[model samples]
Target: MFCKAFRVKSHTALKSSDRKKLRGDISSTFPSLTTEKLAELMPPKEDLTIAKVFVHKGDAVSIYVHNRNPIIFELARNFYPTVYTLWRHPDLLPVFTTWPPVFERMSGGADLMLPGILMSSFGLPEVQQGTLCAITLVGNRAPVAIGVATMSTKDMLASGMKGKGFNILHTYKDQLWAYGDESCPPNIPPEEIEVAPSANLEEGYLDSESPAYITELENLHLEEVSATVQQESGEIKLSTETFQEEKAEIPYVENCNTSLQETMDDLLHQCFFHALKYKVKKSDLPLLTSAFLRNFLFACCPEGQQVDIKKSSYKKLSKFLQAMQQRNILQVKELSKGVESIVEIQWKHPDVISFVAPETVLPLETCETSDGGRKQPYQPPEILSLYGINAKMLPLFQASGHRKGDLLTANDVRSVIITYVKTNELVHSDNKNFVTVDPVICDCLLNASEKHDLLLLKWDDLVTRCLERMQPSHRVAFPGSSPVVRKGNIEAIDISVAQRGSNKKVTIIKNLELYGLDPVSVGSLLQQRVQASFSCTVLPGTKDRVQVQIQGNQVSQTGKLLLEHFKIPRKYINGLDLAGKAGKKK
Candidate 1:
């Protein structure tokens, strides 16, 4: 039977007596059981047969087929212990040593059995079993952050297994409930959006809004004119503020350019898109205080430190870059690869700078055997693997030294690796070559296979290109951290504004639909409209325009006097139509 989406209560806590009974049942199954050997205890082979599969979603990441053991999930909770086990095993140190073991396995089409869970606490989310759904976590690359999706489930019921293998393939035809952190609009499930993880993921199997339907929304150029308004005096005014985020005009620094630049750009773009969802503005960016075209040049020597490209600053950023270049690799090499170290990242973005310093890092590469490939196997990460079950043996065959160790299934490996690559430095650094677009001019050069107006990037190209870029770096360095960002909820506003002096009305803010408004830009954001409107809920058709009054000096001057003079009439407009047109602009 295939899996079916079901909404069980998050608080499915077992009673004290019931918990005791499960514990007792466990001891009966394996009489020699102790807390140490908990993970090592597998259920009866018969119990694991294809009776049914119940996968959980809505945590940091979605669990496609968490069928290994109910207790394994119970113990692992929301944290993913499997990764650490495969990355570096202590007693089984001879097995494998590396970060993000899952990416490798997924790429190779292998599956992660219960025996391979990692326990080294990397803040890898616990494979949680909550009620909400998650975005799909397939095809990610060395993903630092886990993404969840609402299921392809029509409804939340265990009874509706469509048929066979993983139930993710079966579509519910309708959204179950909103999945993920974003409060998906009511009635619309998060899964309904079909988050095509990264630019590389292929289009999903589920049917969704057609090209024309989506294009119609984009072409409207809704964001261009935040809103339109008509005054009581029959005067018209439109004024919409635009936040022009300067694109990265930096030259590719040849081999000197690390995926680091791409990483920074993709990350910033995430911040941009996320902010736009809340209406964050360009002026708010801390670094872009230098916005003039004349001031937009890249300064490798931002502080004129005259970086030797050889020196190691106290900063982790320096160590990270230097490691990629070999200087720090020599340093990390000098230290016993056995001793794990924590690297704290102090990165500065266009906006406020933040810190990401993970507490534990297993030196998998350093924990090598002297005989090159002759090391014993199974060195699991510390966070996973109870009962000393070495995660390495999950592999169908012994790992060839020429290959990376088994951390996750091949598909898992691919998803984690590719998503990381896309979200990191792969696409953004060479966006001009791979992605050519001029939003203002309405020009694009996309060579997607599909013939919809704009080229849609499919999974294969997105992943392959990302992998192609990573192939070079994978040869040079170990895996890097996966920093993640997601869009939050959006708010509604009844913004209104008008202009000053005579009759030049503010058209930008007049009767417009703002789909993605950055949250940070609203406090002092100027919107002068003759009249503005706000909708309780964005419904299709009918009164697309909400109502509002004039604001600022213009409200009294232009808003009031213009209608009296011109005898003009007020008119309402369909803002949604504008949004679609702009998105599909040729």
Candidate 2:
């Protein structure tokens, strides 16, 4: 749940009474923790702070932070240890081991699948549904993730290990880990050593009772399996045979530089096409080359791979772009001295048309992990649509040196209307709250009914009428970019309940792209959080425009996600009132 950054609602030092109670709660939550260990984890003199925070999905949690690391969190009145707590005490909870690749996927916000788990002769640990557990990587005992069991051990075995094993709540390298000093998980060895998994078992099969398996390896122990298995300095040494087998799988590299250069070039092309296809939007055109490379290209590089232009054949990003330009892929122009921007891209170029993206590209949301992780998703600049001075109001605005079509915010409109009233001496002497209706006020700020019924109007009513008479317009501005003034209101995120088939309801959300949200990422997040299936499809007749369809009536969840997590203004969200009591019940 904390994979996303949370907003700290309140932070305060822990009281003495609360400290003692917290220690007791920790002791009770994990019976494995001893008094001494608990004391070390939570010292009396060390100032602990209770941080009441809310995650993107609107869940309120209280976290106990020590040395800037969140050690424990309280959710729904139950206490759970953070990965920091598990790092110091590795054996505090039952751990399910998985492959290293699976850990990266989990950190990217995926549940632990049963097939990815590594099992031993002793079989999986016994845990009931909702029982909290830790996840470790193969050959290392350090816990990398924290989750809860999706089903009982008996149910997992009954299903033949074919579905989601755990619902991962937090993982290493996620926002929760970014909350602390961002330390990596230290390698820790298991207390007891098990024999290396056999080739068949590594392929995800366990035939323990088979006659052939029993005859080949019965009652196998580490020493009996191979004399090469040994313990040195508290670390287990793998069997020589196993080491040789793994070594054989790796291809030999003749020269390190040649291999590195080829790898870097591959990364460049992969990220280049990936960025143009998914990252760049028409609104982001005339994008700076440096910003494109630093923000988009590098972000698309696969995990554990760094993109270095110097290592590639081009030796420079500009050279690579020059090569692409020669191939008719895109055009670059130097708009200012010593600075270049990508002017145009040929969308129908064969290279662009046939560029199939990789299945796993690092999402831009968590791409800033190399830097300090973001506290929340990217918030597009706030755009406001308000009244503009029109032909009818031009005569009144001329005295204030305002143009005929100047855009005005609510406050600006009020200020101008008030100034006009005061300058014309339209305020009634007896009642200062009212303004006398003159010819200009009648033409520009009065309705037919008000003009016929009264000679005077309330100050607020006059301002409201003046604003209603103005033209509609919008303003958009962000750091380092020119402000844009348009004549129409910006489109809001559209959400509506639609019937898929007979009696089947689905929530259709569109216009998220306008707000810098990826339709696929948002759909995946909701699918995991709501435990519902979702699909994304391009809008017909529109290229690059997509909509997300989620099963069931999930209007409330969608609203909270957009409003709280993404920091979107309520005014920019449409159809929230459609989230009836039924949606809340879900």
Best by TM-score: 2
Q: What does each candidate score in C-alpha RMSD?
A: 33.9, 21.7
Candidate 2's residue-wise lDDT over 158-251, tens digit each?
9877667888888877777776646566656554644445753433433232223333543443234432423332223234344334434532
Per-residue lDDT tens digits for candidate 1, residues 299-331, read 111221111111223233334434433522112
Give the distance in Å from residue 449's predicted Cα in candidate 1 to where it truly belongs: 71
Candidate 2 residue-wise lDDT at 407: 78
lDDT of each: 0.25, 0.73
Name the 10 consecutive residues with the lowest summed lDDT in model 2: 250-259
Error of 1 at 310 (Å): 37
List ranges where model 1 is wrong by over 4 Å: 7-10, 39-586
Model 2 C-alpha lDDT versus the unseen true structure: 0.73
Error of 2 at 112 (Å): 0.6
